[model samples]
Target: MSRLKLAICVLDDIQPLRRVGSMANDALVLLFMIAIVLVVMAVTLIGGFYLVKYLVERTFNS
Candidate 1:
């Protein structure tokens, strides 16, 4: 019974380290997803801007 209690105590002490590691992984994945979304948005905006500019120039020049 004493050895079982000691083992439980040791496991409890390690739990927080496991939780911290899990949180770090979650945060890393979140940052990667955000970066991908931002890149896609930037490309879309730039493409739209150039398309509009081209259309305006073509209409006015003709």
Candidate 2:
């Protein structure tokens, strides 16, 4: 009976650690997604700026 109780206690202790590990993984995935979004936004902004500048110059010059 004491052995069973000890086993249960060990399991309980491990459960919280498992939850903490899962939370850490979720946080890492969120950070990765945010970084991807930032990179895409930066690329779009730079491309858009050049496109608009080219169009304006062409329209005015022609």
Candidate 3:
């Protein structure tokens, strides 16, 4: 019984460390997701700009 109580106390002490690791992982995942979103948005904007330029040039040349 004393061993079991000691084991539980040790686990309780370690729980906060595990939570800190989990929070760090969550923060990394969030940053990665934000980067992906920004990249996608930038690509879309650049593509749209080129598409518009191409159409305008074609209209004026034809």
Candidate 4:
């Protein structure tokens, strides 16, 4: 029906704005979580690197 088509057209405009806002919110949350994971991984990598280096040096020197 033409009325149904008109109704859908009206809803389509509003739908995108709502979807954009929700997508932005989701993206922000995902980035924040990713940053936290990266920080943790970086710290662990740094600590492990130093540990491996220390052990290798000690072994070779001794």
Q: Top model by TM-score, which number?
A: 2
For model 4, name the residue pairs that clash. none
Error of 2 at 49 (Å): 0.3
Q: Is candidate 2 or candidate 3 better by TM-score?
A: 2
Q: Residue 41 in model 3: shift from native, Å?
A: 0.2
lDDT of 3 by residue, 1-62 (tens): 99999999999999999999999999999999999999999999999999999999999999
Ordered list by TM-score, greatest first: 2, 3, 1, 4
Misplaced by over 4 Å in model 4 are 1-16
Whose TM-score is higher: candidate 1's or candidate 2's? 2
TM-score of each: 0.79, 0.88, 0.86, 0.59
Error of 3 at 32 (Å): 0.8
Residue 16 lDDT, candidate 3, scale 0-100: 100
| Residue 48 of model 1, lDDT score | 100
Give the root-mean-square deviation of each candidate in angstroms.
1.5, 1.0, 1.2, 4.1
Model 4 per-residue lDDT tens digits across residues 1-62: 99999999999989999999999999999999999999999999999999999999999999
Taking the tens digit of each residue's C-alpha lDDT, what string does model 2 give over 1-62?
99999999999999999999999999999999999999999999999999999999999999
The reply for model 3, stretches above 4 Å from the true place, is: none
